[model samples]
Target: MQVNATPNRRLVVGISGASGVAYGIRLLQVLRQIEVESHLVMSKSAQVTLAHESSYSVADVKALASVSYANTDIGAAISSGSFPALGMVVAPCSIRTLSEVATGVTSSLLSRAADVTLKERRRLVLMVRETPLHLGHIRSMASATEAGAIIYPPVPAFYANPQTIEEMIDHSIGRVLDLFGLETSLVRRWGT
Candidate 1:
């Protein structure tokens, strides 16, 4: 397939302990399919969640992206404002990560990179994966949104009539990619 001539876009994907590990993995897959370079980072809890949700190992998850950084690697390129990434996404973003980013608490590389993205005025999408959100969660989401981060919960779309997990994952990731100005045909349109 002929790839687009546009400059290769850089995307930073952070995975947290949230339940939707499949979203992060599938997002990487779609980015690779489009020939975009991905920078992947995962929290320690995310590793455990991935193990419980899928057969892939941490190394396997790392292989999905062009570059992988340790969650504690604060010196990683993506953690710096100098790094010119097109955007960042924290799929399956846990409440802890959300709070950290919202408050500018750089406990890990994930939150630091998110802070960099916001400070640099780049797209930051958080695919929060919790159910029955409380007031604290709502406040965190509002805080991040005020700082220019897009909070996208993994709500299923009935319009697509998803029949499988992969389809649902694709739909969510596709919408997230749209936030980065990437077009995808993974999900059907509303007026179609």
Candidate 2:
């Protein structure tokens, strides 16, 4: 597949069935605010988690992205390496999603796109949201890291002195985007 010679201010966003769906939501919001084109894909389980975690419906969330894809759509634009993008971010990445990306055996568009990002040698950030890790979880993270995927656990920076949950979420998401060098005012740098 031929990659477009032109560069794009584009990114692929994946939302799995993690607890913090707000991270993915805010990521789309910020990407939009910054004029970046976002191609979003959400796992089926993510719809359920979105309903439980936020007031927004699936359609409402999809509205935030420039292009939205169904999880089962393996033929989606993002599923191909030729799709020009900064890379993919699986915000609030569920354990299952992380394991899939690690093993390169993707069952859904979200993980398949992530695997493509790694294979294409582009940045793939996983905002893995979990705690009480077992050896299996650690191994998956290691595997993902070895495969060139950034294993970014959304550990908050209290030094930002965020007063609200929204503020904390914004700060973490901002840092994640920073991995791609897309800076946003959402984060308050220390002593700045």
Candidate 3:
């Protein structure tokens, strides 16, 4: 597939069924603040996670992005390697999604898009949000890394001295956005 020669200010955000749906939501909000176009795709299980984690309905969260695609939409524009995008960030990526991307056997559009990102040599950040991971999870993460996907566990930095949960979320997401060369004021630099 021929990649678009023109550079575009677009980023793909995938929210999977994990504990931290807030990360994905905050990412979209920040991307909008930075004026970068965001393409959002949420896994079906994410709806249940979202309900338990936050009051925001799925539509409310979807409205935060520039465009939204269904997980079942395999033929979506972002699923194509030729689709120009900075890369994809699977915020709160579930283990299932991680395994699929690692194996290149994507079932949903979210994982398919991630695979496309890796094939296109674009950044694919997986914000894996599980605790007490077993050997399988660790191995999957390593495999994904070997396949050119970044396994970014959203561990908070206490050095930032966050006063609120929102601050902590922003700080972590800010660092993730850095992978795409996006700088935001949400990040509190060290010794500054």
Across 76-176, the per-residue lDDT of candidate 3 in tens digits comes to 99999878888999999999999999999999999999999999999999999888999999999999999999999999899999999999999999999
Model 1's alpha-carbon lDDT is 0.89
| Tens digit of per-residue lDDT, candidate 2, span 1-192 | 122323457889999999999999999999888888888999999999999989999999999988899999999989999888889899989999999999999899999999999999999999999998999999999999999999989898999998999999999999998888898998898899
Q: Give the clash count for each candidate.
A: 0, 0, 0
Give the per-residue lDDT digits (tens) of candidate 1, residues 1-192.
222223237788999999989999999889888778888999999999999999998999898888899998989988888888788999989999999999998799999999999999988999998879899999999999999999999888988999987888888889889888888888677888
TM-score attained by model 2: 0.96
Candidate 2, pairs of clashing residues: none
Error of 1 at 9 (Å): 1.0
**lDDT of every predicted structure (CA atoms):** 0.89, 0.92, 0.92
Candidate 1 residues lying further than 4 Å off, grouped into runs, are 1-8
RMSD over all Cα atoms, model 2? 2.9
Residue-pair clash count for candidate 1: 0
How far is 20's C-alpha from truth in model 2 (Å)?
A: 0.3
